[model samples]
Target: MTATTTADTPTAPQGHPRRWLILGVICLAQLTVVLDNTVLNVAIPSLTEELDATTSDIQWMINAYSLVQSGLLLTAGSAADRYGRKKMLAAGLALFGIGSLVAVLAGSTSQLIAARAGMGIGGALLLTTTLAVAMQIFTPDEHPKAIGIWSAVNALGFATGPLIGGFMIDHFWWGAIFLINLPVVALGLVAVVSLVPETKNPQGDRPDLLGALLSTIGMAALVFAIISGPEHGWASGRVLMTAAVAVAVLALFAYWESRAPYPMLDLHFFRNRKFTGAVTGAVLIAFGMSGALYLLTQHLQFVLGYGALEAGLRTAPLALVVVALNFSGLSAKWLARLGMPGSIALGMVLMSGGLVSIASLTEHGYGGTLLGLLLIGAGAAIANPAMAHAIMSAIPREKAGVGAGINGTLAEFGNGLGVAVLGAVLTSRFAALVPVAATSLPAALAAADSAEERERVTDAFSSGLETSQLMGAAAVLLGGLLAAALLRRAERAGDGRPGDGPAAGPDSPVGVSG
Candidate 1:
């Protein structure tokens, strides 16, 4: 539904190139947010070295962001539309910058966690608003190219996250990783303030605080339940209670949203088959890919004894293949060829196939399992762009922010859940055997400096990598088979236009070249 307040069409400012400037702003914002997700992971080891933080707490370093971001995304998106996208985006950047400063100066683990939560707020704001901003800036024809650019830049940022983090950790302390966000945010703030215009939802939907609260709580409950399940025994009382709370929260959210005058999340979007299917497919693909990725890192570092750079290089195939395929996809009949569901399903299958192939490598070493990782990487890279494009195309440009929020939030959730599920499996299986394995091999056990020894323990960790890989493979295969069977046909654009051209639309994101 279009909002009541009409947004003024963005006009090009003389000597100021509005399009290029907006592109720069969105690219920078996306890079900062997406990179934050993975870059911090590489520093976990280093951070623990510097600070006596526990692994469980360190996991929160990642989870806290996901939790806060995912919980707030729907509300943030709705707020951007209700208030103003540009204003909201700027507020987010400012908050992120503040949080980055906190992290840079953080003395304790709890302080760092709070800073991350602050950064999460800004990130959610930026991520939710960027799509809406892009929708406002570009025309229908130019939109595809812009979206491709945004996608490509996001690809580059996420692709380089590990390499950047690894390089920083090698030279600087862990804090430098976050300290680095400053210059980028500075550039974005300047550019956006000058170039981007304010956009408000003309639909004039009041910010439904109750609806927002319900959705936020519901999502938090569900995510917490999933994440906590593996830590606590799945059948344990805590797990059961969490699940029950999650169910209740979700039911409450749905009921409240359905009745609210202006809901934070538009539940009716699911009535559109394309929207529902695309979202469902999006979540599944992320789950499959994330689960596999979590496992792959273990195999690379633990089993193969790869250094940070080497481990990143091994997974380079995933990024490389995606660039090649995406470049060629611009020329090929990607949109006209497979349509939405077809493209999504095809991608899911390839990803799952590659993941499942890991089962083969379980018995073998570097030679046997390396191929599986490569395949999974390639499959994931190829499928992700298409899935993103499908989600963008399915929604009306007016509500792109909310739609994008849901899509973005789901992707993050899927990634987190994927790691948790597969990781829990690997951890559980490995832990059970660790006691047995430790007793059997005295060499594998830690020395007198027990905690320090464990922190510095790479050799034993590598031994457990095999178990993680097996679990990743199983998860991928299960997801693959499910996608292949469930996704029956391809989905075309809303207009069903023949885009032997790129599958992007009039309001897609920007890329390297705007």
Candidate 2:
């Protein structure tokens, strides 16, 4: 349970005095990266017309960044831990800026996809190192509040992306969306160089080259298969082959990490119930939220006949509530009263209830979905900080980078899987109910020859959406129950509070809570 002092470990018992300033810089960096996740969603239509992009090209453009970023996260984190977090963060910002420039200049779909992939590399480094830096800067007592703010910024980014993108696309050009990242990147770079201290594991072993390669390849293949499944049938040869490769390589990765002296990721982390529960809860929450958002955006645009800007604006309530709760410290208060397990369980149940309410929507308008959005926002605000604390506290300070990377990777995987799986479900249900032969709602609407047929198509789409919501709700509810059970068991076994695990020590940057 003890830790050795290293050059990177903060000597001050209260941790870094400039921790708040450093957190602002970190949150800025994180916002830029997270904004890219949804900003492009609003630009899809513009790009289709401007670049003459095909459906396949458009999908790749969207998938490239996430696929590459998710694949490289573990490797990037391990590198940061071995080398330096601040250095890695600087490199990420520089690369991301360059990628933005490339994207702005891109006139072809292929060029844009390549630019996005490059940004993905930068995003992987940024996302992993940002959290690692935060862990190094803050004491355990301050961890929840810091993480709450960080989580709030994350929600803010997702919410603001569409609104920003929509405005830019309307007022200027499609490239303006990418151009917006430049100022953030420039400021982040300056702040990081001046304020953030270097941190790395002094006793860390040589880089696990083979382990990194296997992990990157496995994760990339898995994401590719998931992305491909909805566009091409799941049973298609390409998806099947890629999925098989992913499974085989990931299995090898597990075996290698278990035996390697300096594994890129330590397989033993999964043995800790707190870590496992937090990770599981993260994936499930991501799955439900991402899937719901994906469907709701479409429903707003196609079914309810809202513009991209309008749809984006309508989704603001969720983000607003999350931000309000986090900044007001209400979420932390709930965490204190409920404990980690109870808070996480309550949050999941709220989210599940929200999904159920959305599923029960009878009126085809935004008013019907308002209550559900508020519930989801509250749930996310309460659950995310607890989950982050549980996962990070279980990890040694030296390995904080990779631990954050693992968390990011699984969450990204859950996001991609959610969209694909839910999209598939909606498509299937629509097909069964629609009078037309089209598999998608847009296609069905276009193919409908009569007014009655169009009505039928809309009805079918609504029914499909309801079904998907219910499915997501059920999965999240079950996951919450299981995660709560595991976390409670860990506590009963004398793990102490989330921040008081084996990793807490005199030299530990994170503090131990009583």
Which digits, one per residue and each the tens of the lDDT, describe model 1 over residues 31-86? 88877877776665566657766544565677677767876777788787767788
Task: Give me candidate 1's TM-score against the actual structure.
Answer: 0.82
Q: Candidate 2: RMSD over Cα atoms?
A: 3.9
User: Per-prediction count of colliding residue pairs?
Assistant: 17, 1
Best by TM-score: 2
Q: Candidate 1: where are CA atoms >4 Å away? A: 1-21, 141-145, 226-231, 327-333, 357-374, 436-514
RMSD of each: 5.9, 3.9
At residue 248, what lDDT does model 2 achieve?
100
lDDT tens per residue, model 2, 1-514: 2234533443443567778888999999999998888888777667766887644465567667877787778888888887878889999999999999999999889999999989989998999999988887787777788888988999998877888887887788999999999999999999988888787774555667787678768877876776666567789999999999999998998999899998877777787888888888988887887777777776776678777787788778888998999988899888989999998999889888888877786254566688888888888898888888888887876777887888788777667667666766786677679998864566677799999999999989888888988888887887688888889998888654333632343323322221
